[model samples]
Target: MNDSAIDYAAVFQALPGMVALLTPGLVIADVNEEFLRAAGRKREQVVGRLLFDVFPENPNDPAATGMRNLKASLQRVMATGERDAMALQRYDVEDPERPGHWQERYWSPCNAPVLDPGGEVVLLVHRVEEVTELIRARGGRSTGRAQGLEAELYSRARELQELNERLRRAHAREREVALALQEAMLPASRQVGNHRAAVRYRPAVGALNVCGDWYDLVDLVGGHRLGVSVGDVVGHGLAAAGVMGQLRSALSATSRVADGPAQALDVLGRYAHVVDGAESATAVTTFIDFDRHTITYSSAGHPPPVLVHPDGRVEFLDRATDPPLDARPDPIRRPEAGTAFTGGATLALYTDGLVERRREDIDTGLARLADSLRRHRAADPETLADAVLLELLPPGGATDDTALIIVRL
Candidate 1:
C-alpha cells in the first residue's frame, strides 16, 4: 500500500477517544466516526461546515459570550503553540436515521498544530473526546429514587466534615509551630556585658496559647552601654505574638543606631505609630544607660517599673512621660532621670496584668509586687521574678497576659 493511501479506518478503530481536525476559521476539516455518532449527523452534514453552524445554539446560551471567549483562547493556543483543553459542552440533536430518537453530545478540545512537509503550520488538530455516556451518568434524571439515599448522603457529609476538621487541625498546628519559633528567638538568658544578669519568664495560663509579653537585653557597641526593654502587645494569639517580635527586634535595631536611651525609645515610638490599626496598637518601652548613669523610658499604657534598693526599700520608677507606641503622631514623651542611685539598684519592669487584679485594685497589685520584692530581697533577679509570679499570680492563673524584666545596677 502507498504511504498516501492512509489507513484512516484502522486509526479511528484503535483510537482511545474521539478526534477531529479543523481549519483556523473553525470549519470542520475531518472528524472521526465517534463525532458523527455523538452529534447524530452524517459525515457529509458536519464536514466542510463551520462547527458553530452544526452546533447552532451554544450550550452556554444565557452566557453567549463564552463562544467568543473560547475562540480567543484558541487563538492563544495557535500563537503560543500550546495545547488547550476545554470542559464538557452538552447538546441534544435529533437523529435523522432513527426517528423520534435523540443524541447527547459532549466535546472537549485537545489542541495540536499540524505541520506540513516543510514544517509550516497547515491546520489545527483537536482530538475531541465525545463523553456522552459519562455526561449521562453525571446528569441527574427527573425521576427515580436512589437506593439508601439518606445513608449514602449522610456518609458523604460526614466525610466532608472530617476532612474540614483535619484541615483546621493542620492550620492550628502550623500556628503553634510558628509561635514556638518566635518564643525560641526571644532572650532566654539575661546578660549585661561583664555584669552578671538573670531573667525569669512565665506565660499567662488562662490567656491564649500565645502572649504578647516580651523582654530583651541587647549588648551595645560599648560594653558599658546595654539596652533593656519590656513590652506587651495589645492582644493575644499569633498576630500579637508576631507584632511583639517585630517591635522587640525593631527596638534592638534602633538602640544600636541611637546614642542614648531617650533617643532610642523616641525612634521606636515614631516608627510604631505608623503601624496603625490593630497591628500597631501600643507597646511600653524603656531604655537604661548604665554607663552614663541616666535612665530614659516610654510607656504605651504599660505598667510602670518597680525600683528596689539594697536597703530593702521599694519604689515605682519614674512614671511614663509619653503615650504608647502608635498612639498618636507625636506620641513619644522623653523619660528623664528621676533618682540617682550609685551602690546597687533594681529596675523591675512588668506588664499590666501582673499588677492588676479583677477583684483587687491596680494599687493593690503594685503593693503586692513591691512587698514580694522586699521580702525576697536576698534572692537573685531570676529568683525574685519567680517569687513575684508565685505570690501575685492567682492560683488559677492570670486572666490577661503578663511579662516582666528586672535589671540591676
Candidate 2:
C-alpha cells in the first residue's frame, strides 16, 4: 500500500505495545489503545492534559522517584533531539474505582524527540513495556538491595528443591528394600492341613516409610493343626517392620510349643516385653483344628476375626480381650474363643488397617467388612480376600499397611 493510503492513525492504535505522543512541553497529545488500557483512563481524561497532571507522583510515598525520572528523560530527549532510554521504573497509577488508591506498576520506557525543519523539538514519541508481572514474580523487589536478595532467594530455592529430590530418591530405595523384606517374611498361599490358605498384603499409598503389618500361616507339630496369625505394629519405618518380623517369628515358634491360641498369644506377649520397640503391637492368633472342625482364636488389642459359614452366616469373634502386647511387664493372658466350622466355611483374619478407616469408627468398618464377606461368601479363599480388599480399601483408599488371611475349610 502507498504511504498516503496506509492510515497511520489506525496503525498507531493497532500497535501491540503501549505507544504515545507528547508535545515538547510534556503534554499528552495522543495515546494508543494499549496505553489507554494500561493507564486505566479515557482519551478525554488524558489527551491535551499535561503528562504529569494525568499521572502525578504518588503523594503518599515520599520516596517515589517515577515522576522525577520520567521528567528528566523527557528533558534529555528535548535537549538532544534524539532518543533517550530510562531505567526500569515503578510508576503507580491511580485506581479508577477508588480515587485515593494507587495501583503499582513497572515499566521500561523510551523517549524519542521529533524535530521540525528548524532542528527544534516538536513532539516526543514515547513507548513503554510493562514489567509489573515479571517484577512481582521475581519477588517484587524494587530497592537497590533487592537484586542481591532476589538472587540469594532464587539460589536457596534451587538448592532446597535439589535436596528434596535426593531425599525422595533415597527414601524410595529404602521403601523398596523394606517392602522386599516384608514380602520375604510372608508365607505363600498353600494347603495347610485340609484347608486352602491365602494371604493378601497391601502397603499404604505413597508411604515411602515401612509399616508393621504382617500375616502368616504355619503348620503345627501335628500335621492336622494349622496356625494363622495377623498383626500390626504401632509405628512406621524400618523399626516397625523389624518389630513385625520379630513378632511373626516369635508367633511361629511359640505356636509349635503352645497347645492353644491363648497359650501361644500369652507366650508371645511375654516375649514382646523383652524386645525393644515391640510394645503396643496388636495381633490375632488362630488355631485351625482340621480333625475337630473348630477354630480357636485369641485377640491382643486387635480387630476381631470374621467367620463366614457355608450357609452365608457371618460371625465376628468380638469377645473380651487383653491389652496389646508389651502393654505391661506382665500382660494378662488373653482368653481364646472357639467356634464350630463346617465344610466349605471360610475364616478371615485381618489387621485393623484392612477395615479401619481414618474418619470412620472401627465398629462401622467392621460392619462393612462383615457385609462384604457375606456378599462374597461363596468365593474361593483368594478371590474372597481380593473382593474384600476391593470393597474395603479401593485404589488409594488404604492409609496404613493391610494384612489379611483367608482360610477355607
Candidate 3:
C-alpha cells in the first residue's frame, strides 16, 4: 500500500495501549482512541489543551507526583533526543459520572522526541501502558519461592507492628508519670497578703508527654509583699519539666534576697548560666505591694502580663528588657515597670502557650486574650481564668501546655 494512500489516523486508533502526540511545549496535538478511553476524555476536550491542564495531580493525595514526573520525562526526551521511560505512577483522572471525585489510575509511560529534518525536536510521542491490573494481580498472587518470600515479609511486618505497639504503650506510661510529676511540682492557688490569686495549668491535648510551663506565688518580705512568677522551659517531656522545677525554685529563693523584680530576674539569669540545659527558659516575675497599691514586674524573654482596671480597661505590660534565661553568661538586668492597681483591679501572669497560636501572630493572639480579659474583668479570679481559656482555646483544646495566674486585688 502506498504510504500516502494509507489512513494513518485509523492505524493509530487501532494500536494497542494508549498513545498521544504532543507539541514540544507539551500541548496535546493528537490522541489515539485507546488514550481517549483510558482517560475518559473526548478528543475535543483534550486535543488543544496542555497535558497538565486536562489531567492535574489529585489535590487530595499529598503523595501524588505524576505530573512532576511526567514533565521531567518529557523535558529529558527533548534534551537528550532519546526515549525516556518512567516507573509506574499514580496519575489519577477525574470520574466523569461523579463530580469532584477522582479515579486512581497507574501507568507505565515512555516519551520520545520526534525530530525534524533539521535535527530539532518538533513533537513528543508519549505512550502509556495501564499497569494497575498487573500490579494488583502480582500483589494478590504468591507461588513457589514467591510464597516463601511473601510469608517472610508478612512475618517481619507483624513483628514490627507488635514492636511499635509495645513502644506506644511504654510511651503512654512514661507520659502519665511525667504529667503526675509536673502536677506535683506546681503550687496551688491561694491568697497572698491582700490579693486573691488563682492558677490554671493545662497540658497539651495531643502531646504524648508534658512540657515546662509553670506558675508560682510566693510571699516576700515576711508577707509585706507578694511575688508571682510564670515561666516555660524551651522543650517538652521530663527534661523540660525538670528545668522548670529548678527555675521555679531558683526564682522563689532569689526573691527572698533580691531587692526587686529586676534584681530577682538578674540573679536568675546568672544562675541559669550554670545549670545544664536551662539557658533557653523564659519568665516574668512580679512583686505586688498592697499597702502601696503598686505592682512592679520584669520580663525575661516571656510574654507580658495583662492588667485589667476597675473600669474594664485592659493593658499589656510588654516592656521586655532581657533575653531568655541562660541566653548569656551574664545577661543584662531587666528594667522593672510598675503600675498602681486601684480597688477591684485584676492582674494576669501567663506563659506564652496561653496567648500564642500557630496560624495567628503573637500580637493578634495577645489582643484576643486582652479582649477576653476585659469582658470578664468583673468576674472572680477563678471564674475569669475559666472564661479566658474557654474563649481562646478551640473545642478540641490547646495544642501546647498553658499556665495562667490571675490575681484580684
Q: Per-residue lDDT tens digits of candidate 3, residues 1-409?
A: 8999999889988878899999987899999989998888888999999999998888997656678768867876664566888866667888877868998676889888888764457899999998655433356476777667656654554464456456657877998898688768888889765667889987665444567888888888844688899998877778888888888999999998888999999999888888786868889999988788888899988999999999988878876556887777657767888888897899999887777765457988899899999999999899999999898764335557788999998
Model 1 lDDT tens row, 1-409: 8867988777755666666677767788888777676566789998999977765544433323324434544554553344667544444444677755545444555677665553334577767665444434444532344434534544554464456456557756966875685567578755665444566555554234566777788777764666777777777766677777777888889878776656777777777765533344455555556766655565555677777888988877656545566666654456644455444677787777688754456887888889998888778777877888888764435556777777767
- Computed on alpha carbons, the lDDT of every model, listed in order, comes to 0.64, 0.81, 0.81
Model 3 spans > 4 angstroms off = 1-140, 144-153
Global CA lDDT computed for model 2 = 0.81
Candidate order by decreasing TM-score: 2, 3, 1
Q: In candidate 3, residue 107 scores what lDDT?
A: 83
Taking every candidate in turn, the Cα RMSD to the unseen true structure, in Å, is 25.6, 23.1, 15.0
lDDT (Cα, tens digit) per residue for candidate 2, span 1-409: 7888899899999987789899977889999999999888999998999999999988986556678778867876664566988867777888988998998777889999887765557999999988766555364454567766656654554464456456657876997898688667877889865668888877665454457888888788775888888999877778888888999999999988998888899999999888888878988888888888988888888988898988889988877466897776756667888889999988999987787654356888888999999899888888998999998873324557788889998
| TM-score of candidate 1 to 2 decimals | 0.55
Error of 2 at 377 (Å): 1.3
